[model samples]
Target: MRVLFTTWSSPSHLYPLVPMAWACRAAGHEVRFAGMPSAVPGIVGAGLTATAVGSDEELTGMSASGKLAAWHKQEQWPADWPEHPDRLSPAQVELLAALGRKQCVIAERMVDDLVAVVERWRPDLIVSDVSTFAGAVAGAVAGIPVVAQLWGSPGVLRYENRALGEEPLPEYAALFARFGLDAPVDPAALLDPCPPSMNLGSALPRLPMRFVPYNSAGEVPSWADDPAVRPRVCVTWGVTAAKVLGAAGLEPLRRIVTAVAGLGAEPVVAVTAAQRELLPALPDGTRVVESMPLQLLLPHCDAIVHQGGAGTALTAAAYGVPQLVVPQRPAPMLLADRLAATGAGRTLPHHVVAGDEHADKLVADALDALLTDPAHRDAAVRLAEENAAQPSPAELVPALAALAAR
Candidate 1:
């Protein structure tokens, strides 16, 4: 069977899908990943065929920082910006809508790329990231099945609002209508990478499928296996967060470093080029390294400090590592709170973070509480157990194979 895995341009969005795509190929199925051409290297690195969809330069030029700055200047927020009455005012909503409308111009081009791929490859099934609706529309047009991979918060889905404790936005239905699909898609399967233990709520309408855990890209560092060293702690905001938060947001990460330094465990900070630019000279005993896949690092780490991105949070859960989620964004914050509520981690506000805040007094206190606290550690471990029970890509094959056999 041939599978076409479609996704958006972002690394956070594309990385989790890598293992599954690899698994599909390992099973002898011809698997191809379609997205912005910038994603080609990652797809090829994963050993999957790359089907370029849009321009790499064009996608790279779309700046989250620029969009946020414009929105901030206009006192605007995107309508899709999570429901934070304080952050997203009526004026902000207008700004967000205007931005969203402009963004659709890029999306339309993405759709055009999807049409071209379908015209040529004509695969049997399209496992797509919902943000890239072109693949879904193409699947519908070609009469192939498309399974949506919801990488972000549940708010993107109509019913997910209620589950995620958000008020339903009737307007989103119209957004979906524009894509020529029912407002609330009855997913063939809702492969939620977020662990159910996180309590994100099950707003998705019931379908033939269920939520699954994320497979993060990093591997466990070699030192993790040593019984001698105090457990290692992995400190990282998601790739996008470390980049977007600039110096101010990253200041908290530095504080996290100061707080954890003298404590028992070794601290490892994983950052990308964007973060390195703002990274203040690091304190001694704290190691800074380039990006190592999340799956690779999580096992060695005793816990995590991050920006509360869904993928990273779930990745930590899958490893049974308690998390400290400092969400600069409300949507990711709300999701972080849910995980904290489940006892998988604790949530910290980004505003209070300061140099003195690193007083190690407060940061160590929190890390100690999370690590020693049976409730938090237990919850994360339980979720890890659940993830292990889940079938890997090989397990999902029978179902897709059945679809193809038809």
Candidate 2:
């Protein structure tokens, strides 16, 4: 079988699809990852064939002008929003619609190029990031089946479906019309990597797959081999959070490092080369490591402090490492909340991080609890067990092939 995986240009969006793509290849299925030029390096870095489709200029401009970050900025959800997605207020509906529109704009930019790729490749199936509507459209146009892969717990899709109905958004409708298609085609299946314990409900038929942490290949730092004398806490802001949140984004990460240091734990601050340039000097004895994959570094650590990203959170959970999540955006906030509910971690909201003068102390306190609390450790271990019990990506390949064959 020929499986083509597609996602937007962002690392967070692309990384989640890596393990499954690899699974297909390991199962003797040929695979290729298609994306905008910005995503090409990441695709290649993951040891997959890369098919660059659309230009990166528009997204680059959006990032430079802060529009991309603005689009990600989400205020706290209403008290009832999470539990009752279908009964959202008008403003909540608009919020989902606005985000859908933004995503559609990105999809619109790539659909034509993606369709061209589909026509040329004639793939047996399409696997896409749940939010990458372009892949869905391209699959529909080419009469191919698509499997939507969720990054974490299902959130955006549920809200979008409730708020906007099954019809395509105006932008999506325009894209469909361009190819003479009448309506958007739904994915044949949804692949959810989130552990069932953390899963928020979804109406779509879901196939649960274990979350395999893949943060691209990198050289393992020599220090990682040494035994930790004290609790080692990893602090990371992911690859795109700083770009999305701008300069202000580093503040929470900085505070997390400080708090971890103050707790007498060794703070292992993982950063990209670009992020390293923008970060200020850390406290004495802080171990700043660059380009190290979290899967390699996380197993050595006792706790993790990060901006709540699905990959980061799930990676930490898979290792049974207690987490202190400082969520900066809406999606992260939701994941953080879920993590807390499961007793595996705690959340320090963006507002508290920005508004509280005692934010550092609060962070320090949270780190202290994560390191000292046995209940947290026990819960985290249970979560890891739950994740381990799920069907591995390799196990899912035959099911996906079966879907495509049908």
Candidate 3:
């Protein structure tokens, strides 16, 4: 079987698909990944063949802040924006409009690439990241089945769809039609990649909205398994917050380091290349490493402190580590709440630690609680066991394979 996969080209979006891609190939199926050129390295790193589907120039050139500014000036805006036009602060309005436009641009530019890949490779099935609507259209045009994948549940799951409310699925189909691609039937089948029981008791449609386990394809690094190492604490804000903290929010990192220091735990900080230079001097025991592989690091850690990206939070839960999430975004915060409900973690809001104001005290208290309290640790371990018990890649590969066969 030939399978075509597409995502938004960001690491967070593409990384989850790596496991399935590898599993498909290991089972003797042909798999090809199509997305941003920047994503090729990650796809290849996962040992899958890749067909580049979009240019990085289109994705990286635009800034979220810039687009928001333009939308603020427009007289009329896309009706589906989450906020009321008159009620929003100028900044908020611009931000919403910018995000909508960015999605539209991404969908438009990716269409040509998706169509080109289908014309050349003619894969039997397409698995697209939630943001890559054009890939779904391209798959439809090529007369193949397409499955949608998501990192987190979109908000529409909680709200009923109507003329006024957000309708991401319908919006995607409309965007594809604009690009002259075939409309995907049962577009609901394409929505996936969210974990089970995280959808707040809403019943999912049977066919495509299946709850597949979250996979970051994180591996246990060899150095992490050593018997004599000190108790570990993994600290990260993911790529988005890493940029924000490094550029606009540097003090947050500083506060976190100060709070975690002298706590008798080793701090494993994940920093990107550019952010590496901005590190404040640390105490003797703190370790500043550039992007230590998380799955490798999680087993070694006693607890995790992060900005609550679903990928990291789920990975932490899967490993049964007590999590302390400071939400940098809303969707991930909702997932954190679900994890909290399962006794896997706690959600520490931004306002709780804002402005480096009381962050040191807040983090110190949370970490102290996570480390010393047995209840938190036990809960984390229990959730980890539950998550671990979910169907593995061996099971998922066959299910998707069946989809391709159909």
TM-score list, all predictions: 0.80, 0.94, 0.82
Q: Which has the higher lDDT value, candidate number 2 or candidate number 3?
A: 2
Judged by whole-model lDDT over C-alpha atoms, candidate 2 comes out at: 0.83
lDDT of 1 by residue, 1-406 (tens): 8889987666767866776676677889888888877777777776678877865454433545455444312211233334333455554454444444434444566666787788788788788775555565667656777776666453443222232234423443343456566653434555555555543344453222223333334555566566736757788866654444457657678778766776767788988767778787767877776667777777778889887777787678778899887766545666777777777788766654543534456678878887778888888888678666666656676677666556
Candidate 3's C-alpha runs over 4 A off are 58-63, 66-98, 152-174, 179-194, 201-223, 228-230
lDDT of candidates 1 onward, in order: 0.64, 0.83, 0.64
Q: Which candidate model has the greater TM-score, 1 or 2?
A: 2
Residue range 300-333, candidate 2, lDDT tens digits: 9999988888999999999999998887665687
Off by over 4 Å in 1: 56-67, 70-103, 152-188, 199-222, 354-361, 403-406
* Highest-scoring model, lDDT: 2
TM-score leaderboard ranking? 2, 3, 1
Q: Judged by lDDT relative to the true structure, which candidate is superior, 1 or 2?
A: 2
